[model samples]
Target: MKPQKKKYIFHPKVIKNYRGNPDLLRIHLTPEYTKVDFGYVAKDIYINGGWIRIAPETFIENKITKQRYTLVNAENIPIAPMHHYFETKKDWRYFSLIFPPIPQNDCLLNIIEVKNGTPNDFNYYNIELKMADGIELF
Candidate 1:
């Protein structure tokens, strides 16, 4: 028959809030691993020219109007950064962002690292295709 293709049974929405440098980067979002719920508040960890901004507590969960979408007051966010070599490589340190699929509802993403690195800046880090069960399952 050869007509079967379906995996990733709801398991993706990570946010490892980073755990290094100058303190204040500790969020243990859990949803079996990382679905967000670390309860943010500890701030302090930024680097613009050297690349280092690990702030995650973002949002995008709309399970039938249970709304939880955020881009920090969104105003034209769309900074697709999959590979431009992150601007010709700066030692490339983990990069991911290719958003363009949202219709299943349930999104809550963020990356509030600022130093004015404009480009319609929407922060960084990415992933969230499917993952829903009963709200914040940790």
Candidate 2:
């Protein structure tokens, strides 16, 4: 049997040069999955008009290895063509995405919702995943 890898959790996280203003809330790296939690607060839109969704094909790519980790599942969010709308300007919607485990050695990734070159796309580039002294969960 192969040696098991330890699990890690990073809470209250931040990323470099994040675009489109979606908040990255947490990240859990486990033997089986790389889970990312996200949050978006309603802003600059009419009440109940702000909306968000994740494309079924959304993915995370390891920057150095050029390896793509495709999205496997999501929670508390809708797959695109569908959307989760905000009830008010102060409302915050939280969701999570699960992908195949990225090698712990890989420290940078791009979370791409799409590559259409629009500012509205939720594409976060060069997100630094510093595992150094990360809080081990298990």
Instruction: Please name the candidate that would achieve the greatest lDDT relative to the true structure.
Output: 2
TM-score of each: 0.25, 0.85
Pairs with backbone N, CA or C atoms under 3 Å apart (clashes), candidate 1: 58-109, 59-108, 59-109, 60-107, 60-108, 61-107
Model 2 poorest 10 in a row by lDDT: 11-20
- TM-score, predicted candidate 2 vs. hidden true structure: 0.85
In order, the Cα lDDT scores of the candidates are: 0.31, 0.79
Number of the top TM-score candidate: 2
**Residue-level lDDT tens digits of model 2 in 31-101:** 88999988777775566648888888899898888899888999999988888888777787889999998
RMSD of each: 14.3, 2.5
